[model samples]
Target: MKDLKEQKTEPVQMARSDLLLSLVKASVSGDKNAVRTAVEGIIADEKGKQHRVLAERLTRALHTNGNGTRAMNQMAHDTGIRGREFLAELTPRHQLSDMVLADQTRKTVDQLIEEQQRASLLRSHGLDPRHRIMLVGPPGNGKTSLAEAIAEALAVPFFVIRYEALIGSYLGETANRLKRVFDYVRTTPCVVFFDEFDAVGKERGDTHETGEIKRVVSSLLMHVDELPSYAVIIAASNHAELLDRAVWRRFQLRLPLPAPTEKELAVFFDRHIQNFDGKPGIAPATLAKRLGPISYAEAEEFILDVRRREVLSMLETPLKTIFADQIKAWEDRAKPMGQEESAR
Candidate 1:
């Protein structure tokens, strides 16, 4: 009787201690939701922190599913967490919404939902409009990240298909590989993202060098046209001008992800600098002013990198040298495309 009483009291004390510690850790880590969820789960349980119990059950479920990443997702699904919510959790937190632009050319989650609804209505009425979208944009403008975010929003598996992986270096092998890829998608409900889609679907021309590209494009067209009604396909490219006409027809939705504007860059800079310990004289306005013509990713990196250089400088050395190096790195990478064009 004495032993059991002691054991019961021990857990209550431990739970309170852990709860306080977890709250502090979550705050320090900037994981507010996690802290809230943990507190709520403890209150609901009305006993101890359920971390070990949940972890054990999760491990058992993984064993049942062959212990793979897919198994973990399946476990999440089995536990009543929606697949889309799970995917969203898998995405990096910073690029969730603030980084994305609200504009006509780009598609928002709201717009994608509307488009899907319309596409469904048309298909029900026997007008099979393709939901296969193509996003064209420059590198580092968040093309691939946007694709993943969309899938995360939709709560579906975002499977990225490398073009090189699909195209074999042999006669008729490309088509065979494509068939296998399409076949896998048929079995899995996933958002299929084809990055560098131009490599496989570029338009053909009079040149003899276009033969291989032509054949691959034809195979792509056939597969896309035959894709079942439920699948969502997203193909991305930096070279939109090169996409074949036939392939364009297969994509009823065309979303162009443009570079971030000055305002968006400012938002990115502020959010990133929040975590940095900097008394650097550069105010947000001054940093934003210096970030003219730079993309959001560039701006975020610039602030954090400069802050890091500032914080890590030797106590004896002048800070100007470190600041100069940061500016030099940014200028080297941020030279406008007009310079490259003029040099040519």
Candidate 2:
């Protein structure tokens, strides 16, 4: 009986080993699709439960890379109304670590990315991963950047919904455009970002809105509800209060990104200075204190402006003097009273 049992198990073990070996070879050759196929075969064989878990992780990684890189390549091939008219696909070059966010915000974003990476494992256990996120904040406060970072972290295509193309002048045309955008994203794993979300997601009962806008809102609600779990949906709004009440409930995660704090500003300046040159002539803490209540985008622009001036002048001026002059100019432009004075 023992010999018969051993004989039956030997072939199954050998097949599993062969499949794993093939997976390794595929990985070594950078054939992500082949690696996924091998992992799928192992999952199908069900010879070792522990091996299945590892295989699932490997399969997910390969799928992410294969889909992401190939989708980027195929973006040019999509010549239809959905591709050319209503949506623009992008490949994000920024990662989460590249941005300077608050500790809590950083943790939340990290958790969201981790959940996406483990989405397959969650689905295997009958759990749904959080894919729908609502980003609410003032303009230039990193809402769009966060969306881009999410795409990079997931290794997925980033699709931005263009309201100009989506909001049609004719009756019912906008809904048709919306459907096309949804249909395009449904075919792949992507981060579909709706910047200036208030345009379409405004409160349905607002008296100022037209009947067509109302219909669009209803259609949007239905589509949001029906979006697949594999596709990530991110909607960013400068005025969260303008969004429909129903819209708020549809998102699985809601994050409010405020302007950079003093500490974050210091970190941002330090990072930019380090990247520009190995040494910093002016302390980042001093600059951070001087640039009060600036957005993350503004800080980046300021750094770039300083770098540009330095390069243009061939380092003839002292770095401290240049930085101080730039800060004073920025402060004058940012202040309403200073603008009024300058006009006179």
Candidate 3:
């Protein structure tokens, strides 16, 4: 009889052990929601009042994870709008060295490093970091890439705001949604990125705009002000002129991304072709200079296309011939656009 009772309890004990293991795994993986859920399950299964109470305490502790953002997390939960849907969690794979930036852009990167270090020390001194930043330039100039690099350097959760999902058709709904996002940010340490910011942050005084847009802008400005310094807010805009003047003042660091210079172009081309076995007969400097003014994104695309063609040909053709042929094709495609620009 004693042996049978021990056997019965052994399964229960084993189940409890599994639960504890799951909780530890979830915590280590930075899944706060999973941790909370597991704790709740443990509390439900626990027979003793003391054990249940202990489990409840653990659940509460897991809610914030020492970030003091429990209130914001709770508010986000109460809103019923899933924060994960609109806020994409990013794990950066690229480092600063991988990015080829211009001299002015490099200065901005240095400033970001300084701010991050200062923020860490200031937290101990009861102060916060200057976390608000703005990236302005034409499309495909590496604004988004810079934001990712900053997030990686800071080692924080990178949350990109999906404007399409956040914006609503109903009156006042958009403002409410925006408020929830801001509330969540207040409770966590993350890099919140708002790409294509002009969609919602346009000038309020435009005659073509409606009252809804004005209210949305007001809500955005208010949230920007209320956000804690622990959360880094990075907004990117291709049309910087469209943004409200009030919005411009909110960002502490404003970095402008420009088209790649001749030197940058050469470096980019060299990096792209470095891994390939075949040598481009033409020098990278000559090709880069001939390519004219193009964005880093365009250069990457051109190099990739050239490489793809070379691979398809079974490496029979020299890379230099392939590079020259690709460049000529691209130039021919752009000739019409260039002519139109000149006509204008």
| lDDT by candidate, in order shown | 0.61, 0.77, 0.77
Candidate 1 on 1-344: residue-level lDDT in tens? 99999865664466445556666788689894555444443342231233556544543443354544354334333333221221222342333464556566444545665544344344334443345788888877777777777676655556767554556788877766676676445433357778888878887762645576677778879888766544578898999888888888888777777787767666666666566443444555666767577765666567667666666764443444554577677776778668977998
Ranking by lDDT: 3, 2, 1
Structural similarity to truth (TM-score) of each candidate = 0.59, 0.73, 0.73
Candidate 1: residue 248 Cα off by (Å):
1.4
Instruction: Enumerate residue pairs that collide in model 2.
Output: none
Consecutive 10-residue window with the lowest summed lDDT within model 1: 80-89
Q: Cα RMSD for candidate 1?
A: 15.9
- Residue pairs clashing, model 1: 84-155
Model 3 lDDT tens row, 308-330? 99999899888878988998888
lDDT of 2 by residue, 109-141 (tens): 888888776654554454556889999999898
Candidate 1: C-alpha lDDT? 0.61
